[model samples]
Target: MQTVKNFSDAELITAIKTGTNIDNAVGFIYRSYYRMLENFVLTNSGNEMDAEDIIQEVLVVFIDIVQTQRYRNEASVRSFLYTLTRNLWISELRKRNSDSKRNGFFEASREKEEEDVSDFLIYKEAQVLIVELFERMGEKCKQILTLFYYENLSMKEILKQTSYENEQVLRNRKYKCLKELTDIIQQSPTIINNVKSALQRSK
Candidate 1:
């Protein structure tokens, strides 16, 4: 196990591959890349939890690739990690936009420099989708879902905040709202395809 001060990317990868435990590698990956990955995801309209999940997923992918002998190290580990993160985020944004029926939000033009325009566009589009999706949901349903998922609030906290009559009521409403969102996602072909591709890639 490599500590924070001495851990390098190679050492971390080795720990991930052969070590009985990989906490050290996980910590090294988090310490080294968390900030950059967080900035990239948050800049692209994801919240804190989204950034956390994506970064963790990136590490999972790195380990998977290494174990499968698919990581050739053609590029620096940092470059490969960044590219994977970028692609995943782009796929997520595409799903969100397609789910919301907002196709023209992203421009097709390319810039000479590696501009972060797509990040900004994704955030903007996400905000729009969030608003539209919540609007489609009733106020009570929207508030319940947002508190539970987005704010990470407990159901007890939500009941107190929203003055829901009981736990059963809150749970029922949350389930229905989530079902609606799931149905909406299922109806979107692009989102369904992206979900399928993501699952396949993971396997």
Candidate 2:
């Protein structure tokens, strides 16, 4: 049998960001984090299968965050993965009316401080909606928005990278792309409410 090599936090982030060796990275994540999280869920009124589903969903969210360059490297990859998996499992337990006493015990035993789960869920929901809206946009709009917002490129830098002839043209296109995204977001009442709730929580 072959062994999968583990990646350092930096190495994992690079692999995910560049779309390089992602399979190896993902395999490493499963081999490393799955059992620990499975045990966690199983002890907290969930079965092995439920743990698997929760871990899978956490990986999806982790990959999306990495791809979007939203991960701040404030914590090690392992720590981040564990935190997300734990929170997700807790959310699931709450939904299923699991043993509250067991849930409280497990939650209290965790080493890290508890995150605001409601805020985390709201943010994730909004992120999904934003990603969907971005995908539905035209290629040009996607490129412009990605450059300006995600990549944090200046107007001049954007013009240099893109086919737009002038800064003014790029700026106008950016405005339209933003407006288009806003329109798409407005169509989703759930997203709007989540965004509002998140904002209120932040305030």
What's the residue-level lDDT of 26 in candidate 2? Answer: 87
Candidate 2 residue-wise lDDT, 39-155, digit = tens: 878886777766766676677667755654457676778778777877776655544455654456564655432343334544654554456667878999988867754554655
Identify the leading candidate in terms of TM-score: 2
Off by over 4 Å in 2: 1-3, 99-118, 126-203
What residue runs in model 1 are displaced by over 4 Å at the alpha carbon? 1-5, 98-203
Candidate 1 lDDT by residue in tens digits, 1-203: 93454466677667766653577667767777788888988876777866765565466556645643445555666666776676556555654444342233234343322133233223423444445656667788888767754564655678898877986677666656655765554457665455445434543
Whole-model lDDT values for every prediction:
0.59, 0.68
Q: TM-scores for all candidates?
A: 0.47, 0.57
Alpha-carbon lDDT of model 1? 0.59
Candidate 1 TM-score over all chains jointly: 0.47
* Clash count, one per candidate: 0, 0
